[model samples]
Target chain A: MREYIYMDNAATTPVKDEVLEEMMPFFKEKYGNPSSIYSLGQTSKVAVEKAREQVAKSIAAKKEEIYFTAGGSESDNWAIKGIAYKNKKKGNHIITSKIEHHAVLHTCEYLEKDGFEVTYLNVDKDGIVDLEELKNSIKDTTILITIMTANNEIGTIEPIKEIGEIAKSKGIIFHTDAVQAMGNIKIDVNDMNIDLLSMSAHKVYGPKGIGALYVRKGIKLDSLITGGGQERNKRAGTENVPAIVGMGKAIELAYENLEEHNNKLISLRDNLIKKIEDSIDEIKLNGHRTKRLPGNVNFSFKYIEGESLLLSLDMVGIAGSSGSACTSGSLDPSHVLLGIGLDHEIAHGSLRLSLGDFNNEEEINYVVEELKKIVQKLRMMSPLYDKLEGEK
Target chain B: MYSKTVMEHFTNPRNVGEIENADGIGEVGNVKCGDIMRMYLKIEDNTIKDVKFKTFGCGSAIASSSMATELIKGKTIDEAMNLTNKAVADALDGLPPIKMHCSVLAEQAIKAALLDYSKKNNIHIEGLEDINFDDDLHDHDIEE
Candidate 1:
């Protein structure tokens, strides 16, 4: 087998051994429905509650407020739709930024078709939501303010506390899609004044199917999946005991070694970024210099398409991602890149390399060396680059 | 989502770079659509002597351009003009359905260069008049 190097952790992460070990008993030895009236079922129930408490403690929320769901998309859907429908009598307006994941943006778009007003506030060139614009877009009819804690594409961290404060002062419910931020950044519901937050286990090295939504106490959201008494009569489904257990262990491990983990990733990320910048000319970094995720490195090479760059990288056994239209399977490239004021051509050339705990300095060095050669080769075949050479 | 043949061509595309002071030059697609292909040709005695291309697009687009240049390198103008987008795709083993438009762009690029060659010498090439280069073939329409 070829030597492989993975740098696409933002897309998904491998389940850790520790998390898997904690979940093994639930899958076979402790297999029972949490709602059944038996000793075996009771064991499952206790395991589920323990996971809830671990999730809540990680974000400083009440254990009862952490309701398990399918994944981040389901958590986001339930949060926005539940809040919007439950508070429809109060208002029909919803506010969100343009850089949110499709879970938030698409839900808002769907709400608009149902007669609800939505304001997609623009972001700055660094992908930060404008605080003044968010404040001005609010109205008496505004019922929810949903923004992402961090962008998935560019990795720019948003001003969540400020946005939460604005929502609090106006008595509007605030929700943040923190799927990309849950384990990477610290969260305190009360300290940030956040009413609701969405998280996924897979992004934090847990199982893929299980996630949690933090609904502050007394925030009565309409039940999204209504069929059973599960999730305290909110989200209804059989508990995924193994996945829930895995998530608990994963979140605990992430927070336990948060400082060390972040320090390693940040150094590797910055080293790679600096090396690329020094080696390549006419390349633009896509996110904020420092106020971005510790693991993200996004850049747009001036005259080459991202899919070609990604393919070239893959040829060398490196896994990366791109914001190019060809990779997106659509005519337009990443909306997040366009939201940050990049032209279509520039957006089509964007590449994202997200470091993780499994990556090391040796892998980073290998990627940098291979990337320089790939970019040079691709640029040589590009007509746009040919024009630049001709002019020179 | 590419075929093995496509990956091979993309990794080491044939006939890359521009032919300076060529008899014909043609460029198609735009930056907005995320693909631009430029083809240069060297013709002698009514035959294509040399052909090269420069492309800014995806793997399939680059591969299509590479294959198209190789197909027409030593063929007569009429033989090159007879090449179809389907032929180019077949030459590459088959592109993904969404990427078939890259083959279309390849076929158009070759004819476009032939038209440029015809216009420069003021010689009439049969069937070149019916080809409307302005019919912007969008990718969405070809995607299945």
Candidate 2:
């Protein structure tokens, strides 16, 4: 069988073997509920507590501030809806950006239907939301300003510290969906003045279906999913012990090796950029060159379709994603790409190859070589390329 | 993963090039959704002797265009016009569930080319309904 190259790390990463090994005993040997009063249950409960403490330490946040949920979407929904509902009397106004993951955008849309006003901030060509625009959009009635720390598609890192400062000055709660940024980037919640932060374990080489929200002390919000008195009654559900344990281990490993992993990713990312640019023309880079995530690289070929390029790469055993993984089937160019001022042709022709823990120089080189050939072959068959070539 | 036939058609597409100074040209798709196909047909004596295409889109888009041309070349105009998107997908061993629309677009581009040919020759084609193209939304992306 041919070896396959898994390069779509931004979509999700495979859990570390060490993390998986640590989580296995919880799934089988200790299946008792954490809510139970028996000693077996107590064992599960203590394991959960240890996991929570480890999760908190990884992000430089306090143990009491972290609340485990399902994933990034839940964290986003809870953060947006919880704040909007709790502060309804304070103001019905909310603020976010156009290029955010649909988790945040759709949640904001839901709030809009419930009589809450929301301002969708626009980003520049580099997918960076204008600080001035975000500031001006804020009104006295604004209750929260939620922006994603790093865009999933283009990998542009937003000005979170400045945005947090602006929201703090206006006495508005600031929440950032740090799902993609959590493991790859260092986020100091206290230093950044972030009121609330969203994260997912899957994106950090952990288990899927496990994530948390960093709700700063003294923040009051109603729970969306109510059943038991778990998570301090802020979020109520039976804990996913195995996933949570795996998540905690993943977070610990990520922090312990953060600098090394980030440096390697950035090196691979920069090399991929240089390779593509050196061989191809009329290609535009999608995100902020320096402020973006170390592992993410998105680019738009002027006349070739992203799907075509992706499929071509797939044939060569190089797996990658075009646009966002969630919205690939919709036949619409990515809103993230469009929001960054890419034209329809370029936007639809975008490719995002995000690297992670297992990727090495050999895999990067092979993928880049295959990509060059695919782009060249596809461009030759492109009517748009023919027109552009004629003009030139 | 696609079937073997699909991969074959994708890698070594049958009708790969464009026909220059042909009897007619028909193009489908807009750049907005990132697919643009231009099919050039050389119809001689009421038979499609050569069918060629240039496509700018995804895997399904290229494979469908290839299948469409392979399915129609040397077939009579009537038989070619009767070809549907489902047949094109079958010819390429079936497109992915999400990308079946690319085959649909391929079938439309072929019919569109025939329509253009019929208009030029004053030979009324079967599916030529009252058609009005704005030339604004499509012309900028798809060219023949």
Candidate 3:
């Protein structure tokens, strides 16, 4: 048997047993079109509405406000473009942070081609968006402000409540891509003043290809997909019933076990961070210390390449990511690292290890030991390290 | 995404470290591109007596340099100069499509060392004239 340890939960997670069990019935026995009026169809419709209520209660949202979509990317696209096209007369301006996911950034870029002005606010060295810069950047013509609750690369948690308050005072619609933050932490849409929120099921140990967008009551937006008037005609398509059912069950379980899970993850994360710091030299930690996610630990070694390190770890049956999984294969380093004031070389040396409920102490120790050896070996072959040490 | 040979070379590299007071030295790539290779050579009687390299790059790049040095260690200056990036990549099974530039760096580093060797000994090597060492960075930039 191969002994493997997976530490890339932020990229995606394995579906839990409960979620899989909940989805099994919907796939085979209860498989029916939720839009149809037949008895078999009504059973699926009831299950879908019950899942909607479960999703809403998890986030303290009203059931009517939750709209399903494909995943985080789609939710982001619909929320941004929907608001942009529907409220073009009210304003042609948008405000977002530089460290947003490409889903949000690329959507804003697409909107810019149609005469919409966008202001990308810069983040601090720790990847926190500057509330002052955000407040100053807003104008009378600014119709939307979209920022992420937690960054996917460095795992920095933003001041979303404060940002939501600012946007609320100005009456501009506020949206947050909570794909990384949804089940890991407590979020109340009413308390956060969030007009629109995006979330994905895969990040929270549910099925992929399904997510939700929480649009505040009475909010108006143009539709992205048009079909048989599903999702109250706001998003039109056959409902992804099994995935939705899985998401609801997964989210319910995530919150139920959140306190115990967070405690376990925080201890494991800190142990990994401390062991690496103590064993390695000339390394810098990325992201905020206490303000980061419970399972996120990122670091950059001075005289090592991340890809080589990742390969070495993989050979030992340990899996980790060099950066955000989306941008890993590109020769260019992560933009999120560059946005946080790291130079190109340091950015190229970044490694992110995200834990999950399945991880244990033994796995964490094994990972740290393997990482120490890999960094040492890579630095031995590094010409820059050789030059720097020779000068000494 | 590397072949077994590439992984073997990367895991247990052939010739690593620097040659002190070496006859010639060559360095290629830059910090911005996240790849840099510094090669050292000790030549005797028109033959490469010893070769060593230190590289900072991805897995393929380190493997390429290791393979390139192995290919030129016992060969004459003329034979070493004939070494191409494809030859080095082929010796290692093959590199990924995106990582072929690593092989290019290996070829450039060898040429750079040979150029330095010719400059010090005042030898009129045939192909050394066309390779402008100062502008070699343009090759990596343009090829991509």
Candidate 4:
């Protein structure tokens, strides 16, 4: 069988063995509903509560503060809309960065249609949101500030702690979609003064369809889903017991070896970036050199489109992703890349190769070797590259 | 999503590169739209002797350009002029609905080249006057 190298961890991750093992009993033997009062149901309730506590502990949040949701998108929607609707009387203004995931951006756009004003702050070329612009965008009527902890495409880590402090000083509710940063970085909600935060399980090597929202105490927003009483009457639905158990174990394992995991990823990421930079000409690194996610390595190879490069990589058993319009099934490329001031052509050529716990030095070396050949091959077929070569 | 033929053409595209001092040259699409096809044709005795293309686009775009160049090679200029975007799409089995515009781009590129050929020779070809290469061929507009 041909060896496959999985590098698109930012997209999703394989569930860890330990997490799967912890969740096995919940699927079959302990299938009772957590809402039931009987012993078997009580066992499931206890397990759910334990997972909630595990999720809370990882982010330095109280056990009662964490509310389990379906996933990150739900958490994002719930946080943004819940705060907006409940506090409509207080304010109608929302502040967010232009580079936020569609979960946040689209939600803000939806709010805009309902007469809500949203300020999309601009970011620097390195994909970092300017604190000055962020501060300037804040208005007296700003009720909430929602920005991602780290970008999904570029992996640029935003100034969450500083942004949190600014929002706190301005008496505005601060929320961060930390789905990408949950396992990669250590987050202290208390220290950061974050009023709300979003996280996902699949990004941290847990099962999909399970996530949690951290709503700081004393901040009461409207309930997300309305149905039978569950999640303290905030989010209403039957709990996903096995997935919750998997998330609990996955998050615990992630935090348990956070330092080692980050170090390994950072090393591999840097090596890949350096090798690609040295080998390929006319390439631009997309995100900040240091103040970025440890696992992310995004670059734009000039004169070649991203989808072709991705196809070439896939043919060599290397899984990768791109910010091109063709890959996204849209007429425009990634908003994050465009937000960072990349023109359509450069943005179309962007490639994101995220590292993870499963990758090794040998895989990185192999990927770099394959990448050099692929870029060269694609460049030769490119009319843009042909023009440049002829000009030379 | 692309057909197997599209992938096959994209993998080993025929007639890649430029024709130096060619009789006609045509370029279509733009970098902003993330697709550009440049075709070079060598015409002699009103027949296309050879054709080559250089494209900077997605897999389907490259495949479309490759297939378009192959369809017109060794054919009369009038024959190449009659090639439609639908024929190019049909020849490749079929492209996804969204990517049908690539076939449109391929058709436009051929006409643009033939137009270039006519302008250079100062001779008019039937059905060539209607084409205006200046109009933007946005990827969203899929031609029938």
Candidate 5:
């Protein structure tokens, strides 16, 4: 068994055994391009449809609504930019939140240069986009409202249903990047009024390089990729049969265990939070205490830095993300942290440990112990820590 | 992962405090961007009597700040002013390429505070006005 402790579930999850099993045959003698006319090709096509059905069933959507893309970024780009271009005659304004993943933000930014106006709403300290703010931001020209269902950085969930409802009343479309929440949380696109939704396979324990966007049946969007007809002419190019197959299997498995998994995850996460909070001083939790995801525990220590904390934990065989992978090299803190009102020092000290199928009490305990030591040692050396101590 | 030296300096940072009624104090960085360094100096008779810094940054950031204070303390104003970011990185065994900027920021911040002190004492800090602190602050801007 692999002894490494993997806490970076939010970044990407390990492929589940069953998902891999479902994907295996697609790579071998059973392999065929889904677009071809031969029998082997037909087999792959049927598999793709079945996978599509499996995905649709999970979210209570029709099979034709799900369009597979390269990943969350591609799906996000397609959704925001695709919809923006296709709906240009309807309106040229879009509403979204400040804490949105760069996928949405960058796409919106790209649209701005093309004559689309975007309103970026601010979130509260816990990272929830306010309903009033959403309503106010909507205008007659507003065509879409894109907000994440759950934050990738702080794990704070926005009120997607309320925001979706508001958008619907105004005759505007609402899209959610549910990449982190899909498998972990039960989402009813119909109930939430999520007209367009996005999910990544890797985030749900499937494979990387495969993701899907849920475009409501009547919604119009220009195809982001122009190529051979595939995905009902919405998405083009060769389908990732193996990865899509794995995604279907993974989604099925995730839904089957969603409740139980969340229960386990919530307990573990809460326990981990408690253990660390009790052990360390000057520690502050970043996300909403209750509205946050079940598996994520994000916190900040006053005197310690996140990279130092991460590397210290890495030394003992633990892996996790500081924040969004997009902003990894930049010295600036995670924008989500800043949006939630954390200044640079504390934000730089932010650490997120997202639990998953692998983490258990023993591992949590080990992390706690190791973390306590690391924080203490790092704080001892921190010039800021010294000053804080001096002030005390 | 980081080197043992980085981990060491990060784990035992030096000059962690604020100077009161001091000769000079300089603060730089938008902490909202994740790295902030405030350098404090106490100079008497043209010799740096005490040097301290409080930095909120990554391992290399804390290490560089610690190294900066350690390098400048007990030195004359000229010697402290002559310190380079390279010296700080070298003292910490060597910072990662991405993190070298942290040391560079620390060096500029140290020089910034010294420049302020020179202005307060009416001494022309050699190359103080000639060197652009704001331009050196380019790396600190959070573009993403």
Candidate 6:
């Protein structure tokens, strides 16, 4: 069997062995409901609190402020809908960026159907939302401003601190979908002035189906899933004990080696970029060169389609994405790519390679070499390339 | 999603180069819409002796072109004209619903080549006259 190089970490990561080990006893040996009043249940309840503290410390958030949920989508829905409905009298308008994950975009679209207005802030060519445009779009009736900390496709880090300050000074609620940025970047809720944030365990080398929504103190809202008054009656569901334990351990490990992991990822990412650029022609780099995530390298090769390139890479055991993994099967090019002012052809030709902890220099070098060959072969077969030659 | 046959054609495509000074040539789709296919044909006494294709698109588009070329290589002009997108898709075991358009490119490219053949020979080919080469060929069935 060929060795697989998994470079689509922005989509999801493999669960750490240590995190899985920590979660093992919870499944069989410590199978008890946290809602139960027995001593067995107390063990589960204490485990839940400990995981909450672990999650809290990772983001510099208080344990009381964190509410466990299913994952990023739920956190996004709850944060947007909860705030919108709760403050409907105050304002019916919400602000978000065009490059946000569909978790936030679709939720905002749903809100638009029910008389709530939403303004989709556009990003610059580098995928950075204009702070001046954001300020001008904000109206007295704007109740919430939910921008992402970093983009999933191009990996452009948004100006979250400035956006947070703008919302805070205006006394409007601020929320961030930090699902992609959580493990890759350092985030302090207090320093960033973020009112609410969303994060998922699966993106941080933890198990799926476990995530948290950070709701700052004294900010009350309607509950999304009303049940047995769990999660302080804010979110109600039976806790996923094993997954939660895995998340806690995973995040604890992620932050412990954050700097070292980032350094390695940045080096691999930059080396990949330099090698590819040096070897290939008619290729344009997507996203901001310096402001992008350490692990991200997105590029658009002329005269080729991304899906074809992705399939070619897959044959060589390299896993990557054209844009967002969620929207890959769709015929339309990524909205995020288009939002950054790329033409439809350029957008369709885009590729995103996101690295993680397991990637090394050897794999990066192999990928760059394989990619050069694929691009050359595909270009030869491309009608557009023929046209370019004919024009020349 | 692609079938086994589609993957086979995509991996080792047949008739993938251009025929030099071909009798007729047809190109359809565009880079702007993400799939561009150029078809070359060599017709001898109403029979397609040679057919080749060059495509810039997804895996399905390349596979469709390869399969389409193989289907029409030895067929008469009339028989090649009867070829449909459905037949191309069926030959590939079947493509995903969204990727059904790639097969359409195959059908269109063949029709386009026949149209070019008719124009160059000045012989009015039936059914080839109706093909509108200017229309946007990429009609994606995107749900709102």
What would the per-residue lDDT of candidate 5 be over residues A322-347, giving only the tens digit for each residue? 75211377646788988998876777
Better of 1 and 2 by lDDT: 1
In candidate 6 chain A, where is summed lDDT lowest over 10 consecutive residues? A323-332
CAPRI tier for the interface of model 3: medium
C-alpha TM-score for every candidate: 0.99, 0.95, 0.96, 0.99, 0.87, 0.97
lDDT values for all models: 0.93, 0.86, 0.89, 0.93, 0.85, 0.90
Error of 6 at B75 (Å): 1.6
**Clash count, candidate 5:** 4
Model 1 ranges off by over 4 Å: none
Q: List the residue pairs that clash in candidate 6.
A: none
Candidate 5 chain A — worst ten consecutive residues by lDDT sum?
A323-332
User: How high a TM-score does candidate 2 get?
Assistant: 0.95
Q: Which lDDT value does model 4 have at A241?
A: 95
Model 2 ranges with Cα > 4 A deviation: A324-327, B1-4, B93-98, B129-144
Clashing pairs in 2: none
Candidate 2 is graded, for docking, as medium
User: Candidate 4: lDDT over CA atoms?
Assistant: 0.93
DockQ result, candidate 4: 0.84
Ranking by lDDT: 4, 1, 6, 3, 2, 5
| lDDT at residue A313 of model 3 (Cα atoms) | 86
Q: Higher DockQ: candidate 1 or 4?
A: 1
- Two-chain complex of model 5, DockQ on C-alpha atoms against the true structure: 0.36
Candidate 4 per-residue C-alpha lDDT over A1-392 given as tens digits, one digit per residue, 9 for 90 to 100: 35899999999999988999999999899999999999999999999999999999999999999999999999999999999999999999999989999999999999999989999999999989899998888887999999899999899999899999999999999999999999999999999989999999999999999998999999989987999899999999999999999999999999999999999999999999999999999999999999899999999999999999998898889999999999998989999999999999999999999999999999999999999998999899888998787799
Superposed Cα deviation of residue A4, candidate 1 (Å): 0.7
RMSD of each: 1.1, 3.3, 1.9, 1.0, 3.8, 2.0
Q: Which candidate model has the greater TM-score, 1 or 3?
A: 1
